[model samples]
Target: MSINWDLYNKRLNLHGSTQRDRLTKEFKIAKESKASSNPSCKTVKVNGIDKQVFIVAKSDKTKFSISPVNSSDTLQMGDKIFWKNADWLITELSLDDDVYVSGTIQQCNYTLPFQLNTSDIIQEPCIISDNQTTVGQDQNKIITVPDTLKHILIQYNSNTVQLQKGKRIFIDKQVENPSVYEVTKIDRITHMVGEHGLLELTCEEGQVTEKDRSDLLIADYVSVLPTPPVSDLCEITYSGFPEIKVGTSKTFTAVFKDESGNVLTDVMPIWNVIVPNGYESYVSFSEDGMKLIVTVASEFDLIGQTITIKLSNVDNPDGITLDVKVVSLF
Candidate 1:
């Protein structure tokens, strides 16, 4: 008899089951199948149970004879069997030596291993797992400002918070956040100061204004002062005679001015003069003395030598000074 070529061709062309369907069927079949029957497959037994060996091996009858692997031990039928590697449990056994070894079929209480997705895991505040309250101490928090800040203004409801000369605050105009400012100076009372009001605050050089203060909830009405117009007056001046020959006398003078061209007479001005490859010279004067006179030592050399004069006031207000370069020989 010739085989059915068409039927054989049809069977050969048929595709095997898909991975998903195959796995599903495999699990269903395994759950329905009974235990195996083999002496080697019988692993562990529970105490006070039937003296029987529960085997877990490939067999058609799926039955086993319960027997203790060691002769001295006493086991009873209907005992439990536990496998080491598979962690399988056996619920039934038989004591007859002729009976094939088999374990009672039971559903496994297997649990799927838990896995975490780092990308899906959110941070503390956003996740509910974090239940502790966050600490808000001053030492733990740091205030920062943008590099472009040039000045800052601090506004408050009342003058209760006095503004000092130096304090730091933060400001960010681009963001919809409240800018912070530390007190710089409370120069005058509200009624005495001009209409716009004043609350000078020391801040980054560029952070000087508050875009919004409606929600600031403060004591009294207050705000940061606008940037003052920079003065063009000379903050410092240095004057000195040109280079001196081996033995000569030199006179140096310096002048200080405020925002206005008017002279500043609050403190005496000091002068520092330096000669190339020579010792530094310092001179102090009374508030009335703006000029300095000094005699050049005879041992001083004039060749390839120059003098530099610098003038500064008390603590060098704003750390600004004026310098004068002298090269001509006297």
Candidate 2:
């Protein structure tokens, strides 16, 4: 018999899924939970200004309670949350097992200003904080930006998101010679069917040395972002469960790569699962079709059964087929 989860949701005063609508904040979250998500998010204004999230939880000094926020996004890492009159950065993303997308948030100190497609600097509302070490590294910080401007600080990758990772720009163009910062790192925050739009960036203050002065130009306020190199698909790597567990679905994934081991994110891979004539199996695929899942009813389906799955790409007719076996965990 299925356990009545509503009994537990009520004991917690969640009132079922209605808890997300009750005493929750409205956030501009992503529309998709997979790759190819949108990043160029336009802010939503309430009462002539952008919306802000306020936490009433007394859980800790900085940690917010597990209250739900209204948004279409998957609530993943690299997504910023405005809190405590300051913008706090989300270091961990929520999982499917989570009771609301709960995680830790540190205050942001700065914003990685952007000029989408060489336009004027799009002053991002919230802060992103400065980095000390490696580019695109995830670290824990107690940092924060002013809370008056509350919003999530989402960053997009320089590749599929159409921006340059190393592009340089001025925080303010009005100043005679404003400070320059270069985007040294980027992380994709939005998810449509796939990862897309506003990326998290790790920018370091840039210097204008005399040797570099001649290279500066008036027409080009910022360096043009470079497009990712088009590489031929060289190999495919398959990752899957060694054996199918009882009463559990197993997932298998394929990673397309080039000769240099760089992931080829542009390809569309398809999966095919086959079982023996007497066996019954249910199959599924991840949102981006990069993963395949297989599940059988019980030992009845396992009797005299052998399972196999193959990966292929329709676009790349030359792509090789990978055959992997799936045996019963029992």
Candidate 3:
């Protein structure tokens, strides 16, 4: 059957209208983007051409035409926008085209661990020595003599009965030969009476008399008498101040005690007083004097006054006690 041109044209028009309606329906079904919830959104004027853009509701199905307004409202997907003013950072973007921009959002930053300079830290130096040890471990052992060998003497006999003076003798039992005895004294006989000649012998102790012969003997078993050991004879105890004003007397008592702490009474105590600028004075006492009085002259008027006093036994002299003190007379 032959088709009519006019009828075909009319049918074409109807189909075109139907197709347009269908496209419109499809565009309406497409999802639209929504505005961000950030409150910083504001309306600003866009200087460029006006354009219609589709904005989707939060449901994503509804579409709205966003026309450019004078003020930009939070630049939502549905809002009309013309121009952007300044460069603003975008903080959040929603899947539905919601944009959140921030002007005051801080930039990315980081902090490193704290460090100290050389001046801030302090270090102390220490002395370390392997040679340094405890006190008692380094002390010297004291020498002790057996009490049984404290006193011993030996005598020798010779054909020359007269002995010289000031000679020493050595006696020991371990040697095979007899030890030698030096002659310490000599006695000359001048006369012979009757049938016997007079004889005499002398030793270092004194002129050996006939009565002293009982104490002398010639012996095989003998040893030299050991010298008495030296010990701290006395200690001086202080009972006074070291410094005194000029023309003023400072009285201090010194107790003379033996090693056993017994007061030694028969000896005199000697003292030496020293002033600041090298002035020295000596003071001594009688056999019964234990306390000493020291007087200082007023010529030494200096700010840090210092005085030294030394005390000792006058007879023994080897043992000593020392004391020093600084005082202000001003």
Once fitted onto the true fold, the runs of candidate 1 whose alpha carbons sit more than 4 angstroms away are 1-246, 278-288, 315-330
User: Which model, 1 or 3, shows the larger TM-score?
Assistant: 3
233: Cα error in model 1, Å? 4.8
Residue 91 error for model 3, in Å? 99
Candidate 1 lDDT by residue in tens digits, 1-330: 999989876665443346555555454344334224433434453532433333444453443334344323443322223444332223343334231223343322321111121112111100001113334456777444334223322222233233344443333233455344443444344312223222333333223344323243121224544443332333433243244444555555555566445776665766665555634442212233877665554443344455555556565543333333333344
Candidates' TM-scores?
A: 0.24, 0.32, 0.25
In order, the Cα lDDT scores of the candidates are 0.38, 0.47, 0.35
On residues 1-330, what C-alpha lDDT tens digit does candidate 3 reach at each position? 898989977866652457665454343333122223323223433223343232223332321223221122323211112223321111122333222211111111111111122112111111111112233422475444322111111111222232234433222223444233333434343312222222222222222223211222222223344433323555545455444555455666666656556876777767666555545442222222677666555544432455666666655665554554444455
Candidate 3 accuracy as lDDT? 0.35
Instruction: State the weakest 10-residue window (summed lDDT) of model 3.
Output: 106-115
Q: Per-residue CA lDDT of candidate 2, range 120-170, in tens?
A: 445444344443333342366544443211123454434225655666644
Candidate 3 deviant stretches above 4 angstroms: 1-233, 245-247, 278-288
**Poorly placed runs, candidate 2 (over 4 Å):** 1-66, 69-89, 96-98, 126-153, 157-160, 171-177, 187-200, 208-330
